[model samples]
Target: MKLNVEQRKIVELEPQGHLAVKGVAGSGKTSVAIRRVSFLKEHYCFEPDDRILLVTYNKTLLNFIHYQFNQLSEEETYDSFLSEHKTDVTITTIDKLMYRSFKARMTRLGLQLKTMTNRRQLLKVMNHALYDMKDNYKDVTILSPKFQNFLLDEIHWLKACDIQDLNVYQEIDRIGRATGSKGMPQKLHKNSETREAIFALKEHYDRLMLKEQWVDFPTINLMALREVEEHPPEGYTHIIIDESQDLTKVQLMYITHVQTDKPHQSIMFVADNTQSIYHLSWLGKGRAYTTIGFDMSGRARTLSKNYRTTTEISKAAYGLIEHDEAILSNVDFVKPALIDRHGHAPIYRFFKDHSSHLVFLKQEIESLIGEYQYKDICIVAKESRFLEDIEQYLLSEKNSSPSTQSSKTRF
Candidate 1:
């Protein structure tokens, strides 16, 4: 992929104290970040020990980064270079990076750390804590069973904000809440039995965590932040943060601790606030803070032209999201015109029922398979149940196909 004018500038950026880049979806922020790392290693005389940490939003994005890195380093010269200096660069999701940091300091900090691997485990812990509360504390059956998820979400929000203490959690206004279906802010009631129950559960959860030697996901970020703040990390030459708009305060704090005030070290943040769906974690309470971390002196830059979507698609998207003030403020104050590369308009199909939906989907898949490869087509489901059903249908379709067929159609 050839670097566009904006992307080239980012790739060729001088290794300053920090660089803050706001890029739209198609602006090649990842490519720029990767190229910048390569440039620093090749030009700035950065040693293999000076780790270039590339942190992204999630594991899927981390995999994408790894794939891109692999593709870039496939050449003999770069392959040998990356092979020899493997540890020189670290590409991972923020959670993985934080967990690594927390794990490294766990023994020294005298903290028995255990991370919950899945939602089932997390729910189990929450239920056990709730049961303990019910058995010990006043039976606050006022808190409905459905509120279990909301309570857990609130806990995560508090932890993300570094509000571990019960008093602080109660006093903190706003609580970084997400909106309910009624478009009302979902918040914890002050001085209510519900609040008390939640507090007790938090305590129980912590006790259980310590007892079981385990920690939840969001708590990992909080722990990492605490560790980094107490002991400022050293040795990293540069940090490239992707999808930074979705970062919580704790994650920002970790970044703050890692990146020193010195000019030699570099911190780069690549994000599009418009694409920040993670804020929905708190029911719309969280927004991308301008002064991410300790300072805002980082050179601010924007990538305006979107290279991925068609002009019509871009316009449609913009129209849909333009009403969001948070996106407008964090991304581009004055909605920048995206110079989208022309392509097919997005297709929307509606079905009366699940069976009809699957029939339409299968037919569409068969139709599109003639022009585009299986990898080129994607069927998006709104929920996991729908996805499971679709997957089973696709599997059955493949299984029923004739064995004599030379090529197999894949989903």
Candidate 2:
């Protein structure tokens, strides 16, 4: 693909300060980030020890990026650059990076670290801790499902923001914690009684985790942040963070401290605030770039033209969040300009029950299978259980088993 003027500018950016590229979906932000890495290797001379790090949020994205980088490296134009910078660029997810950085230190300290992988198990443990708190505080409201859920979210927000001092958390302005029919009932920073109860619940939860010898991702992230602060990692000349909006305050802090002390070190953050799917409430409505020591001012760039999605799809997606206050308040939010391509308008269906929904989904898949290959069709659900249910229902259908035709059908 040929580079656009905007992408070329980002690719050729001088390797010296921070550069933030806020682009809409299908705006080729990831491509620009990859090209920038190639540009740096081809254009600049690096010390033998200097390295580049490209970090993402999850394993799926990490694997996709690795594939893309490998493809780019295979180009004949980059052959010489590949030979020199093959091992210099490290691509990894934030969780894996933190775990690797902290694992040795944790083992040396005689800490038996066991990460809780099962979601149901973690929730059960959390609920047990919450019930224990309720018994001690004599607050029946703590047992309310809504309150319990709010408490869990609040605890995550506290850890993600690295709010260690209880006093600071109590005094800090709660950005996303609003109170009304739509918001959380208890404000941890506002009501003293509520705040105290929540803090106690947090402490209790920590104790339960310790007792079970279980460590969650956020705890590992916090530990890594502290470790990075005390013992800053060296020899990283450049860092490119993709999907940066999903990063927590502590993660950003870790990135800042891990970069090398060399004069020409650079960091690029590519993100779309509107596309931020992780840590939605935790980041609140605050401008993360400035708060985390990035001076975007003139260094920021926005990509408005969306190349991947059709106009119909883009408009439909935008319509859902066009009036959303949270989305509108985002500092990096951009109304994407649609490309020339046009596609079928998105259909929104309302089903009374799961059976009807599954029936409709099966019909749609069977209909589409004639025109498009099974590998090209995908079914998405908010939860894996729903997808599993759909898969089973489809497979159980008499004389209409999609698995019999092709193994590529995906959920």
User: Which has the greatest TM-score?
Assistant: 2
Report lDDT (Cα) of residue 254, candidate 2.
87
- The digit string of per-residue lDDT tens for model 1 on 1-411 reads 457787888888788777778767777878788777777777764443566777887888877766677667424344565786687766678777787778867866787766686876777777777766666546565343455666676666667777667776566565335455433335556665566667767777778877978888777777777777777767477788887777777776676676534456788878776665564232123343453533444477878777777788888878877887655554333254657367777666777888999888877777776688777787676568899999888777765644213355544
Q: Candidate 2 vs. truth: CA RMSD?
A: 3.2
Clashes of 2: 0
Which residue pairs collide in model 2, if any? none
Error of 1 at 256 (Å): 2.4
RMSD per candidate (Å) reads 4.2, 3.2
In model 1, what lDDT does residue 266 have?
A: 84
The residue pairs in collision within model 1 are: 114-214, 114-215, 178-282, 178-283, 178-284, 179-283
| Each prediction's whole-model lDDT (CA) | 0.68, 0.76
List TM-scores for all candidates, in order. 0.81, 0.87
Model 1 deviation from the true structure expressed as Cα RMSD, one decimal place: 4.2
